[model samples]
Target chain A: MCNTCGCNITPGNREFAYKPVNGKTAVSVLENLLARNDDQAEHNRQHFDKHRLLTVNLMSSPGAGKTALLEATIDALRDKYRIGVIEGDLETENDAVRIRARGVPAYQITTGSACHLDAHMVHDALHKFPLEGLDILFIENVGNLVCPASFDLGQHKNVTLLSVTEGDDKPAKYPVMFRAADIVLLTKSDLLPVLDDFDPERAELSLRNLGSRAPVIRLSARKSLNLGDWLDWLIGELVQKRGKLASDVLVQPVAEPQSISSNTGMQG
Target chain B: MHEFSVCQALIAQVEQIAISHGALKVQSVKLRIGPLSGMELPLLEHAYPFASAGTLAEGSILEIERAPLKVKCEACGLDSKVKPNLLTCRMCGSCKTRVVSGEELMLMSVELITT
Candidate 1:
């Protein structure tokens, strides 16, 4: 029987195509819906790799202290590494301006109605903001826990911030975001003394329940409490990336220049 | 909602496939979505028609298959299907389990018209 219309024809019957009512054919096209986005992410990754930039994507809800963390991190690492920031917001350049005030190169992407920062948007931002000579590029994604976790913006690491004000159940509530995180930052730790409802151990437990082994660090960017752990994590990632690149340069000395040039010169 | 954007992407991919295969219109689209895929199925279903309007997949049926969250236990060396909230191994009940399969949002196949 016809699936669409009540006719005496079954599916995969090519003979029925000649009939008036059964003209449809089923094509087995197995494809990924996120292929377009993932392709763009890979392209962005190549660009970052060519410049030897360690890119980290920060995701959180609004007022999660992502900007404040970036400000403190920039201040701490400015003397050591060249840092740049890509701030994503709905309608303002407020976050970008804050980063720039600290004497760092910052580019803001106002997503308009979009809730998350996609790879395509990040790719466009890369064109406007040069990635050269930057040790670290922080992509402070839109303050959304749900959407940002789904889209890959070609970042080497995903850092999720859960403010103490938001309760410890956030990790359990937003398991997808927590699972995607390489490291979870329990931000605004200074208020822990006053707030008796939130527990750091419970938050880490919820994250671990999601089958994620990502380490959780408690820090107050404003108070600079236990901020060294966050800084150490960033430095460790940078050192690991440099080690990988150094080994690549040694193993494929001839292939390194060709690949890097092709990636860098492709757009030009 | 981001579901609308995700639906738009899905419709665009389906339309492109239909056009590539010289299809007259899309009859049905099959998808395999997992619990951990970070997409609300109801919202995606609600946004489908609007996103697919005036496109090849306008009147297409969306056949969504829900996949089980599967994990592989490192300690037990066994793979088992588990709940989304608790991703531990079912047989061994180990916390050191790795996600083998679950977080997938794949377009499995499409049914289209030729004439």
Candidate 2:
């Protein structure tokens, strides 16, 4: 059947063509749509390495208290770690301003209509940050649960925040997001006790069902409940990053000079 | 939905592949989207034309294959292909199943017309 004009094509009057390729075979491309984005993410990873930065990408739905959690986290850890933030929102410098008020350098990327922030956006945003002195870089992705899971923002860790009011079935309903997280932050735990339907065990089961081994830390950024545990987790990650950096420095000072010269020569 | 952005990415990818292969037009783009891929298939199809506008893949047919949810039962240690809504293990009725293919969004292949 003809695809258009609602008429049968005569011998040579065909508009659509599906030829036999004339002996030149077609190439088979089994590629992912996000391949280019992931490549850029890898480039961003190397950039993070160049600056000895430990990057964490946080994802959640809007009003999941991502910004509030960040504000609290920044206030608690600013004295210990050199924190920097790249805030992604649909539209507003509000989150970035909040972070800066806590004394951390912040750059905001307003995605406009885009539901998520891709690695290319993060790569571009890196130019605004003086990453040399930054120890931990947090890229708070646009308020979205689904879209952000597929796009890696060159972060070393993925923390997905789910507030109790959002319900226990989130991990079951939106498994991809929770499955991608290294740690699931159960925000708004202060309200959980009052809510009759929100069950913590039920939520944990959903996480387990998705094969997520991410430790769930329940805290309320609004009330500062269990914020200590959250702070400890951050401190532990920072210590690991610092330890690795120290080990790298130690090895660099004692490594053979011939390989170093060859590497330097390649750049020259 | 987020399908517009996904289609936008898909268009960018298809255009690059077509240009690199020196192909003049794309005949078909085959995608394997899993049930747990977090993308709506119909919305993606609707967004395709807009995303591919002014590109080589503007009129190309998007062939989407919905990959079934495959899970490995933690208890039974066996793989089971199940429906999207029901993720429990068929053999053991266990909810402790690890998803294997429910999060796929792969461009399996592209048929291009080279001049």
Candidate 3:
């Protein structure tokens, strides 16, 4: 049998053996598998721009207090910001139900057996939402770090959460997620005193090493401690994004970069 | 696990490639997963069969090539492979670095079997 593709073997068939004809002829076509996802993400970006809504994609591992933090955040910003949430999960509508109970528009996207929320799922959920009055949209990505980082949800900002119990080395262990995030939130800080190896300083250093200069905020959702800072930061970001969008339409035409050199500049 | 999602995407890509190649089925999928990509090989392998069932890659084997994390350090100005945890420059111990390569998750090629 061929090891590369698991082709079946035949007796006295040297052609299908180690030197199979056309076996080495396999061409090297380098393509990013996330290309399709990226295309959909671009569409989602245009859609968000059309509606002038600020979107935030929240990511974290399971038990990282994503839902709890959102609950607290919604309560803090509900009076000021017209917030909407799209919750992604594998099985349950539990997070959506909790968010909706808080009197905000929340939709649940059950991916069936899938582990991440792609741009298509969020695009589908957009129809169910009233985009006219909403100022901010929160997409609670499926509880995973790896696959979700490969996908972009057309959000104005991507926020990654890590609980104190999950260890401070998460940024070191998962650099992709940390590098892609616009902000990193450390949740469940109340448990820090009870836990032994919960080093906030070391975690901050690790986050810095991951090439993320995003402001890292520590808060305990359960105790609602230091949550004001998180809420303030989110509101500030939303305001800044909204202001930029409005100014982009009114003040300046789209600026195209002129190539001064042969090399194309990297896109942020 | 998130590997199941990646497997799902892989299956879709393989099916598309097989159809375009006018093949009956995909024989194998060649993937390049980077070291800093944070993908667990064992979980991805375990989820492959489950995700590929009823698709064009129903019986296709997934072959993965692991790429090391290549970085350029600001202090040392040397490009080298570094461990995932210790991203600092090996020579100067400086943490200022930029990733030049090895953060890719790509499907390089697909082997299709024709009748």
**Per-candidate interface DockQ score:** 0.49, 0.37, 0.36
TM-score of 3: 0.78
The models' CA-based lDDT, in order, is 0.87, 0.81, 0.78
Ten contiguous residues with the weakest lDDT in model 2 chain B = B82-91
Residues A1-268, model 2: lDDT tens digits: 5312113434465324224365222445566667778889999987886676779999999999998998988888778778899999989999999999988999999998888999999989988777867878999998888889888778888999999999888988887788789889889999987987988888887887666668898999989999998888877886787677556655785467664443222232
Q: State model 3's lDDT.
A: 0.78
Instruction: Kindly report the docking quality category of candidate 1.
Output: acceptable
Query: Model 3: per-residue lDDT, tens digit, B1-115?
Result: 5677767867776776566445677778899988766578899889999999998889888899988787798877998787766676776767788787777788887776665
What DockQ results for candidate 3? 0.36
Q: Candidate 3 docking category?
A: acceptable
lDDT of 3 by residue, A1-268 (tens): 4222223334565344333235332324467666667778889887776666778999999879898988888888778888889999998889999999999989999999887899889888987876767778889999987778878778879999989998888888888788888888888999999987989888889988765568899999889999988888887887787677665665543354432111122233
Better of 2 and 3 by DockQ: 2
List the RMSD of every prediction in angstroms. 5.9, 7.8, 8.6
Q: Per-residue lDDT tens digits of candidate 1, residues B12-53?
A: 888876775567889999999888899999999999999999
Model 2 bad stretches (over 4 Å): A1-25, A242-268, B83-90, B93-97
Query: Where does model 1 exceed 4 Å of error?
Result: A1-22, A253-268
Which of the two, 1 or 3, has more TM-score? Answer: 1
